[model samples]
Target: MGKMIVRLWRRGFLSALNRGGDPHISDEDLTARARHLAARRHLVAEDGQTELTHALATGLHAATELLEEAGLSRRDARDRAGVAFLKSGQNLARWSMRLWLWVTPDPVGHAKAGNKLAERARMAWGSGLTVHQENGPDHATLMVTECVFVDYFWDAGRSDLTPILCAWDAQWMEIVNASDRPVSISRSGTLAQGCEACDFCFKRKAKLVYSAPFWDRLRGPGHGHG
Candidate 1:
């Protein structure tokens, strides 16, 4: 409805694109959309950090309005908008290029893939993190919760495994617990496809994986950070 509100909506839309959005759009086009949304929100600049200043309450209201306009019920709009912002903020971090990548079949595969990633990450970044499974409320998406807080940076990748990233037959539920503080939890796993069929392909993408401390320090409320 208002210009600022529209900008907020655009930011959410850009986030979806960053998280392996529709395959139809080219990377260049999606980058343009992301920049445009950021510009409208006064979040982009020639130099310096792009920060989100609006109160959470304001963002919540705007997102609710937009979602309802799109035909979702009032309650659904609020929930969806809330999660969208949480995820979009993570997208912003992704665009900022402050995080690294890690891939494995799922949390269960953590024992196998995580230890290796942790070892290399610790050697490279100074800390190691563990993956913890987290369950969501009934209405939210199902996922495996991995905690990257002990010595990490952040995670901004997609949970989908098909067209983008191609991690696995995984579904993810991103958990955003704090606004004033930095936090993100992304979920992924294959519902229809098991790890056997998708394991090899997933490991290949794991090449982009990051060091463990890269994620640990950035993940929790208790962890110390720079």
Candidate 2:
């Protein structure tokens, strides 16, 4: 992650922590915990990762450690980090989604572009992104057919943390499912969740309603964004 992304993620993480954190765990303590995690290079996933994915792996691994050190259960730490990561990336994710939607308005076209994007991403991540069944004008599925992190986390005995990386897509998917967009992305299963793949199902809405633009609708929850 870049300095800016880390800063944003940190901000969001703190906010998420404060909302329902243990009464004993102060904001300063969590901030310091995150800072300590960020201070060093924590190597969790070594191979089959891009610089970005490597950062995600190490960051998740580090957060797992820090949270554990802070007396959180493994599940709570990952879930909490997942939520914070989702909040942190919402802005850019929405904008990229808006731009992608603009370029490929129709669901089928957008699905094709998603395929290309996955292909390009594979060059970096060392795993394939499978965009399946673009034949449907309004429905498609995108998934990590082979996620590199599977092995890394499994080896580290921290596969539970893999879902935190999956959080990167949660915001964009939410945008797709938002009212303004003509499409809907749904994925109830994930590789980290013990599913065969991290599936993101894209479906076009049967009808379009223009109450408020999705961007404007997004502006509220998107506020105080990290």
Candidate 3:
């Protein structure tokens, strides 16, 4: 996972930098940039999930800085970084969701699968997750009161990036629900926005008529869509 993240970050960063007439950024320079951002953000490359998340955050921070160096404003640079990161992982996200749907053939199975995965993730991060699970015949909901990503970014003074991470959840869920046995997620509040908790309600539906425009919206003209 760590190596994959590094590759993703490198690819995304170079892709963004290429737009400014230079794709020849050296690997050493990129690594130095990420290390610099990690230092600025107080992110340590600890073991397990800490290392993974911090690496991603550092890479994203570096990407933003590179974009800014290319003459974009801070806001625009961050926006571009978010889009680049998302686009880089879209294929993986889709494949993972499809595999999950294949393994969990029914609503109950799907809910259980989700719970197991969430538990593993929580254990990996080792902090900042409070989950409540409610399961019914046709639905399952996971109410998260505290999110480690939100806490980590907030403490790092990069809380603005939390929404970009939250948007990935919506994107992945959208991919999952696109399966035959559609399971839709309804989220109202988010810790990123200073809400008490993130209310994620996943319900089984015969036909879910919803489209996630997160990517398109984020890539739009202005940051209004964010």
Candidate 4:
């Protein structure tokens, strides 16, 4: 996840040159593209909602694609994705506090950045931003948020399942993707069968499996079985 964030940041910055807009592509344009892509497949919302508007559709589609491609187990993917969203300037007026902290050492600068990021995230998400502790450095959570935001990229279709699966994983629920049943969780919290479809899932399956006992032990004494 850490590597992915750095990679995305670098790609976003480089793309900004020819792409125009902010450090990343404009969210409006991206949303438009998402709608177009989704429409072609006749995707519909869960409740038979109207097709996505051309204006907001593309950006939503792009966000979804980015998340799906990020692969599950990239714990930080959400936060990083969120940062990228902010960079596009579609959600808020400025970069997030984490961004400021990442770039500078001053606590005040970090606070300012954090407030800006939080404000934008709330605006984009409607409700206040929800925070979750990802299993890595703080940046991991930011990337995960960004990845989740990508779900807006496409209209709901079969593809919508990608985000749904991601959400379950994001919440650390025992749900399975590409399978209908709950995945086997060992005595430890790790999954017995990895989600092969997820890049990170596939990569970390072994390690997670091996660490199951430790994870289980780390869970408070009375926590559910891993």
> Which candidate has the highest lDDT of all?
3
- Estimate the TM-score of every prediction: 0.25, 0.63, 0.74, 0.24
What is the alpha-carbon lDDT for the whole of candidate 2?
0.59
Better of 2 and 4 by lDDT: 2
A best-first ranking of the candidates according to their TM-score comes to 3, 2, 1, 4
State each model's CA lDDT, in order: 0.33, 0.59, 0.66, 0.34
Q: Give one digit per residue, the lDDT tens place, for model 1 in 137-156.
A: 21112232222221011121
lDDT of 4 by residue, 4-56 (tens): 43334334533432243322444454545565775775554432112212222
Q: For every model in order, what is the number of clashing pairs?
A: 22, 0, 0, 43
Candidate achieving higher TM-score, 1 or 2: 2
All candidates in order of lDDT, best leading: 3, 2, 4, 1
Span of ten consecutive residues with least summed lDDT in model 4: 183-192
Q: Name model 3 segments beyond 4 Å from true.
A: 16-26, 123-132, 206-226
lDDT of 3 by residue, 1-226 (tens): 7667667657765675555443334556667898887687676655556676666667666676766786788897778778767776677679877776654535444575657535644765544467767666777667788876787677767787788878877887787656554466678878888788787777766544432234434556664212
Kindly list the per-residue Cα lDDT of model 2 for residues 1-226, writing each as its tens digit. 3445545555665566446565334446654554454344354433444434545554556555666677888788777666655665677788977777654545545565647545545555654234333335556666666675665577667787766667677777777666454677778788777787776677766554422343445567554112
Model 1 per-residue lDDT at 192: 22
- By lDDT, is 1 or 2 better? 2
Best model number under TM-score: 3
List runs of model 4 lying over 4 Å from the truth. Answer: 1-22, 46-61, 64-168, 172-226
